[model samples]
Target: MSNLIYNEMIKMIRKKRLLVITLILIVLIPIFTYAQYKMLQNTIKNVGSSNWRTILQQQIVDQQNRLASSRVPEEYKHLIKLNIQQRQYYLDHNINPNAPGAPTFVRGFVEQGISLFLPLLVIILAADIVSSEHSLGTIKLLLTRPVPRWKILLSKYIALLLNISFVMILTILLCYLISGIIFGYKGWTFPVISGFQSKGEELITDYVHVLPQWKYILMAYGLAWFICIVIGTLSFMVSVLMKNTASSMGVMLAALISGNLLEQVAHSWPALKYSAFTHLRLTDYLAGNTSLIPGMSLPFSLTVLSAWAIVSLVIAFATFTRQDVLT
Candidate 1:
């Protein structure tokens, strides 16, 4: 089993998916960092102060004004209200949510990317993990080996998990190294407020508490890792079911995109809460962000994602081990 996993890992390394993901991150992180820097500069210029309190107060006022306007949609009003509550919490605690640091950037990046961007990266890695073997006519060679079909599939799945972990860790390191040039590398120990809950328009502070920035990052990224694993597993299943790598990727991409669209209307459609895509943003729970769909909690999201992953794995294995390898 160990040899099989190692061989599979080597194959993945040879395929250059890791290197491709690295290149994508290398090209993108700096752009993100620069954009963040520009946004900070604009904030300072527009507010005419670097003081967080003043800037936050102005933001609160602006959001409140928007909330009062009829042009804002109902969903957006709820989101705006939640943002107001979170910002107010920061003000009351005298904490700077946008404290200049690489760690701060990482936290924000993970939160923003959890639902869509990070999952897309996972899809890139896992979408072709199985289908590519067929595309290259390697599946027959793989199955002819004395090893059991299930073991072969398991090895590939393990390799996929490792690659995803490596990519996620690389994302954090590269983001820190690149963004630190402008944001400074300090602030790991900065206090962060979390645990805000939403009950309709009202923000519940009863469960809120403070955490060190480092701790918050770990918790957030840990959830992100789980999310990536779930997404990768689903992609693996898709890769197993399809013979064409492109088709597998397209299917996962469409599903993810549709899931995002569903999130907008999830409130009206309660069944969406059970979807894996809706649960992909598990980091939001740690950040105390409210979902448009009510009744979502950390446990509920975890259960939904876990169920999807398990079901995907069962389908992938059952299909792969039984299906004839004509390629």
Candidate 2:
């Protein structure tokens, strides 16, 4: 089992999906960090040194003015409200929302990256894990070996978990390196106010206390890791069920894109809430949007995602072990 797992890991390395993901991150992070750096420089130039308080106050006023506008849309009004709430938190706590530091850029970038790019990459890798073997006529070679089919499938699943973990860790490392170089790595100890979950016009009265930057990043990424695992497992099941790697990828990718469509069109539909795709962006929970629609919470999201992962694992094992290798 150990040797089989090692071989599976080596095969993944040879596939070069990790190389592709790493390259994408390498190219993106510097460009993203540079843009943030330029934005910060412009902010400093506009406000002069030590003027975050002025910027914060100005933003609060701007949100208030937007709220007072008769033409502003309902969605924008909610966003404006959240913006004002965040800025007010900064003002009340004597913290600067635009503080010149690594923590701010890391937090913002990770939130967006985990919401989309990271999961997409993980899905791509998972989509090919099993299907590629069948496509290349390599499943027969494995079936001829002494190992049981279930164990062989288990090895690939373990490798997928390791790959996803590596991706998640690499993402954090790249974010720190790029943002630290651009924005000096200060303020990890700075407090960030969060846990202001909103529903339409009103924020829930219960809120999390202000936490230091490091703690929030850790928790945020931890939740992101969970989302990735759930996504990867489902894609791996597709990989096991399909005969062609491209078909597997297409199935999972279409499902992901379609999940967003359903979210927009049928969020309140019965038990659509129970689908894992509905909760793929669990990091949104960290941003106080516990749902794209109401009636979803972090705990419910976790439970639904876990159930999906478990069911996918069962399907993968059952399908791989029973399916005929010979045509």
Candidate 3:
């Protein structure tokens, strides 16, 4: 199985998938850095005072005004309340509400970036894992070996997982390195407030815990990586069913982007709580905000994503073991 995984990795390398991922980072990391640069510049130029308490107080006022407006939706109010609570948490603890550095900026980016661009990279690697082999007749040659069909697919799955892990690690490293050049390398040791729980539209302030910033990043990235793996497996299942790369990628692409689309199209559907997409933004839970769909919790989202992943893997393996290669 290890050998099979190695061979699969070799194929991926030969296809220049690694290069593709690196090139994407080359573009994306700079964009993230630039965004942080602009944000810091604006904060410094506009805030008039450099004190954390004053800035946080200003933010509280802004949120209050929004809450006062009759136009704010209940769900958005919940998010605004979360933000206000977090800022207050910092102020009450005598901790500065603002910590702009490599770690903090990267954590902020990961929370938003995982839901958007990370899926595309995962899909590009996984969507072709099976179908491309079939299109090239390599799958037939592999199946002719004495090895079980399931083993071959399992090897591909492991290879895909390793690739996903690599992407996540590299993204964290690059985001920190590039941003550190401008934002300074401090704050990796800074304490952060996390472990927040929600009570309907309000954050349950007492239960939230404080951890080192590095630990929080690891926990946040771990959750995000689980979501990506779930997405990768689902795309792999689609790849197994489709014989062409285009069909496989198209199916996964639709699934990936539909996660965001679900917010607009399916938020009203109560049944959406069961959907994996509803849980994909588990970062919201960790970020001290309400789930994209109300009533969705982190544990619930994890279960939904795990169930979808298991069901997809079963379908893919079952279907592949019985599928005829001589079509």
Which candidate wins on lDDT? Answer: 1
> What TM-score does prediction 3 earn?
0.94
Cα-based RMSD of candidate 3: 1.8
Model 1: worst 10 consecutive residues (lDDT sum) = 288-297
| TM-score preference between candidates 1 and 3, better one | 1
lDDT of 1 by residue, 1-327 (tens): 999999999999999998999999989999999999999899999999999899999999999999999999899899999899899989988898888999999999999999999999999999999999999998888899999999999999999999999999999999899899999999899998888988888999998889999999989999999999999999999999999999999999999999988887888999988889888888888888777777888888889999999999999999999998764
Query: Which pairs of residues collide in model 1?
Result: none
Q: Residue 22 of candidate 1: its Cα lDDT?
A: 93
* Colliding pairs, model 3: none
Over 152-221, each residue of candidate 3 has an lDDT whose tens digit, in order, gives 9999899999999998998898888888888888998788877677776566777777788899899889
Report lDDT per candidate.
Answer: 0.92, 0.81, 0.83
What stretches of model 1 exceed 4 Å from their correct place? none
Total residue pair clashes for candidate 1: 0
For residues 125-181, could you state the per-residue lDDT of candidate 2 as single tens digits? 799999898899988998899998889999999999999999988888888877888
User: Which model is ahead, 1 or 2, in terms of lDDT?
Assistant: 1
